[model samples]
Target: MMDQLLLALQGLRRSRVWLSIFRREQLPQTEADWLAMNRRNFFVHILPAKIHKGSTRLSYNWIWMGVISTWLFVILTITGLFLMFYFVPSVERAYDSIKEIMNSVTLGRFMRNMHRWAANLMVFAVFLHMMRVFWTGSYQKPREFNWVIGVLLFVVTVLFAFSGYIVPWDQLGYYAAKIASNIADGVPYIGPQVKQILLGGTDLQQPSLLRWYVIHVFFLPLVIVLLIGIHFWRIRKDDYSKPVEYERGRRD
Candidate 1:
């Protein structure tokens, strides 16, 4: 049965119609051919065709914090989307909506818990990922710019978490947003202006809630998506980010 299934799968893979519709284009049969094809293939080009064997070792790279961050992001996005269906971003309704979701919507509380925890986990993962990179000396040489990009991504991640914190509009979220805005007001030159722009007024009210909702749900997510694409592209360009020692004298 297994041999018959394998033969059938092989025939399906070679079917001209299946190839044209699903595969779209053939994968290169050789390393050189793949390198050439990668230049024009967006999905295929985002990751290297091969990584050094040492790069796959836990002892060499420690924990896979970067991979963990990516998975956490996926979980957060999924749970966030589900929560969005029941969320109301207005100051008057935001807390009530959360209550309703928790008390009424099936598995809503679980989803909300997952979203919140996953978001927090993503922040921790990104921080550890940065630390891992620093410890491994992966931030030097051709990866300096990539390290800069990673820093920016960390900042964005923090801001994303902060923005999302106010969505529920409860006392905790309300006070948190107030503190954050006040910190913005502490900026050197544009302090007051920054606070005003963030709150959309002299205080946190309806406009502030709306603005945070827009930023958390739309603007920040879009920016992060673009940055992540560049991050992956650079990772591919840097030879799948094998440790610097792999190219030195460590190969055994």
Candidate 2:
């Protein structure tokens, strides 16, 4: 029974969509390298070095980017949670609270900066990774469904950035919210109302602060969590593809 279970797990890893298309491994090659790659026959690249008989897929990279993204978010969450203890979420107190954090709390500034930077980095990394997957045609056929999940994550990331921007309650954040809500007013029939609801009026003010807080702290974060969970699980179900040819041997 244990052996069968182990085989089952191995099957899942080998079949991950992440391994077959995006990951590449170093393999031995002749000194007579083709494509002017004489000095570089097998070194490194994106796709893992493996041959597939259209059935026997070899092992792929297990460092799931999806999981790494989640880990980054986890770091953000813990750091953000610590931040909330110091944050008051009000217009008048917001700036003062930030100062208090830096001066009073031990390593508070470091934690806050880490959370902010990690959130930004997570979004940026996810975007680049998505582009890599798309261009490499990793979303082909059996993986198309997870590609959809990727799209959701993209939107979630935008929402995360937007909502997070307002928490600082800075002048730029105020204007940022104003412009964003103005765009929301272009949503057709109910656009005006949505603009009002989101901005908490026709202007960016206190109500806007609370609204964005609810979204960043409560609503959209929930969606991100849900979508991220599905994204990882589905990748496990989707088919992992293997490269049929090599692009360039990494010498440099």
Q: For residues 136-244, could you state the per-residue lDDT of candidate 2 as single tens digits?
A: 5667766778899898898888788877888888877778788889889999999999999998877777888889888888888789889877776565455344342
Model 1 C-alpha lDDT per residue in residues 187-219, reported as the tens digit of each score: 999999999998999988999999899889899
lDDT of 1 at 116: 88
Best by lDDT: 1
TM-score, model 2 to reference:
0.70
> Model 1, 26: alpha-carbon shift in Å?
6.4
Give the Cα error of residue 68 in candidate 2, in Å: 2.8
- After TM-score superposition, the amount by which residue 36's alpha carbon in candidate 2 deviates from its true location, in angstroms, is 48
Clash count, predicted structure 2 = 9
Please give the lDDT score at residue 13 for candidate 1. Answer: 79
Candidate 2 — which residues are off by over 4 angstroms?
1-64, 244-252
